[model samples]
Target: MNDQKFVDAVFFELFDENFCRYQDSLTKPTTGEQDSYGRARNALALLNSAQRLDVVEFLRVVIADTASVILGALDGVHFPDGLEGECVVSLDGVEIQGDLQDMFLSKAQNLGIYD
Candidate 1:
């Protein structure tokens, strides 16, 4: 909700897509997981100090969207009656942890956001 958070979010969004796009271009180690979100957040930690408002605006739009919902879902999910659970799903032959991705896709579908 804050400017830094907004910029961080945009950075994450872009980082995520770029990571996926160039995945095959990068070499992988057998021991570590990709810190994709961490990379983006680190890139914008001082966003409020920056002069540009574009990244902040982009983060606002993104977080106001299903992507944020997905992140929330990834972290945790609550039902209408207050039930909660972890969610995951298979999409395009890849297993997506539905906890966040599903929540994101569902909201995006409702909002008509898609690839």
Candidate 2:
């Protein structure tokens, strides 16, 4: 798939499946409520645990396609604990830098994944 198509697919999986539902679960009327950071973190965690090849591949593609916007969104965002160790994009068993995790979270937030 092309870059944009791959990015869209990954996002569709995020929003259409577990990510949106997970955000809903985290919401509490009494509390001030969480933001896209939690939603993105949990979603990435789930994707990482699944070890889906398509997701990893598309992530690489989208990194080139959308890095600037994602990077811009990264400012002041708090990464989830252990995020550096848990989620990743690897090619031939070689893990890319932890920046990919931040990229993923930023993309999700920019897309309004929690909404």
Candidate 3:
């Protein structure tokens, strides 16, 4: 798949998996907290709709912006040449090794989050 499609797939997979875990962790919110939990559930439901592309796009932007800041902080670290094995990100059981900032920025640009 192309970089943008690949990144989008990875993003959605991660979001779906993590969001389910998050919902599980709540394990039935109390009466006072039900509204908040219900809202979250409704949001997820909306994301499943074809009409909610705008919501999905907005979420992608938010995720990319947040990830950029986190990954940008690693820019100052100097790794030895032989230490490449230590840096890897597993997406769909495949280990990808590269400069994460560059990878993320490229994908973000593909998403039109940056000019």
The C-alpha TM-scores of every prediction are: 0.24, 0.27, 0.40
Candidate 3: lDDT over CA atoms? Answer: 0.51
lDDT of each: 0.44, 0.45, 0.51
lDDT of 2 by residue, 1-115 (tens): 2333444555567555644464444332223334664544545555533453344334434543354444223322334444342334444455443354355556666764333
Q: Relative to the unseen true structure, what is the C-alpha lDDT of residue 22 in candidate 1, on a scale of 0 to 100?
A: 39
TM-score of 3: 0.40
lDDT (10s digit) by residue, model 3, range 1-115: 2433555555555455653455464343334434666665455554544534444445556766666554444432344444432444555665443445566767667657643
Each model's total of backbone clashes:
6, 0, 0
Candidate 2 local distance difference test against the native: 0.45
With candidate 1 superimposed using the best TM-score fit, by how many Å does residue 20's alpha carbon deviate from the native? 21
- Tell me the tens digit of each residue's lDDT in model 1 across 1-115: 2323433444455445543343323222223334774454444444553422444334434544535554555445533345476655434545544245344445445544332
The runs of at least 3 residues in candidate 3 whose Cα sits more than 4 Å from the true structure, single-residue gaps closed, are 1-37, 41-52, 77-99, 111-115
Q: Deviation in angstroms for 41 in model 3?
A: 5.5
Give the higher-TM-score candidate: 2 or 3: 3
